[model samples]
Target: MPTTKKESLQFGLMMCFGMVLFMTIYNLFLSGFIEAITLMEVIKEFIIGFLIALTLDIFLVGPGVKKIVSKLPIDKSKKINMVLAMSTLMVLAMALFMSVFGLAISYLHNGNEDNSLLKDYFSTFLKNFIVAYPLQLIVMGPLVRYLFIKFVLKIKCNCNEY
Candidate 1:
């Protein structure tokens, strides 16, 4: 979604905010939030997740997807179609990386390490990706992109014009 470092940073910040919110709620839900999740816990998760999301998206996945997606035989003449395609790719890439970040945060929070770290982490990644993909594509992705386009970048795309 971002072609430059400055845009990437802004995009990353938006994504980090959205994703951390989603993951915090999802993780707590899985752990049975009925047991009471604390404000401090949420804060910690947000901090760690934000850092991970920002770093991974900006440096690794964001640029990689840009190059790869640009080569795809998509109907790029239409901005809406291009945006949708990019959003899908971004979600998938972000989910993949979320596995590593989730595992680390879980370990840090609980201070409990699994013997089968690799296996467990892979499983965690897969589960997270499944849920995150849809949430990003349908909700957070568009919202963040819109905000970026309007407020941050302030560039109105001509995609909707014939």
Candidate 2:
């Protein structure tokens, strides 16, 4: 959806902000930490998570998704087709990488005494993918696009231009 580099950066930042916020809260709730999580703790975790996610999304996942989607067999002329392909791959890649980041954070915060790192990583990846796929497609993707058009593009209605 972003035509220029500046627009791409803005779009990526907005997407990362919402996705990180939602995923952090969702993961904490899933891990049963929501009951004990303080606002300050949430804020701290969010800041860290947002930075990591934004970095990965911008430097790694964004370019990779574009490359992969360009190679896909879908009809590129159809904007929806290209959008869906890119979104799907982007979500998949981000969820995979971010799950590892999440697991590392969990290990650092709680310590993995059970020595089940591989198993835990798989579980975390699956859980993250399950939520992230739909959240990106159904919510964040559209919402960010709408916000970008409204604010970044500043596309005012013609009736108000008079």
Superposed Cα deviation of residue 16, candidate 2 (Å): 0.5
Report lDDT per candidate: 0.76, 0.89
lDDT of 1 by residue, 61-162 (tens): 877888887999988899877777777787777777777777776676565554588787778777887888788878887898889888766553454343
Cα miss at 92, model 2 (Å)? 0.6
TM-score against native, each model: 0.77, 0.91
Worst ten in a row by lDDT for model 1: 153-162
The reply for model 1, stretches above 4 Å from the true place, is: 1-4, 33-37, 109-115, 155-162
Candidate 2, residue 130: how far the Cα is off, in Å: 0.5
State the lDDT of candidate 2 residue by residue for 97-158, as single tens digits: 99988898778767897978899999999999999999999999999999998887774344
Error of 2 at 38 (Å): 2.4
Candidate 2: worst-modelled 10 consecutive residues by lDDT: 152-161
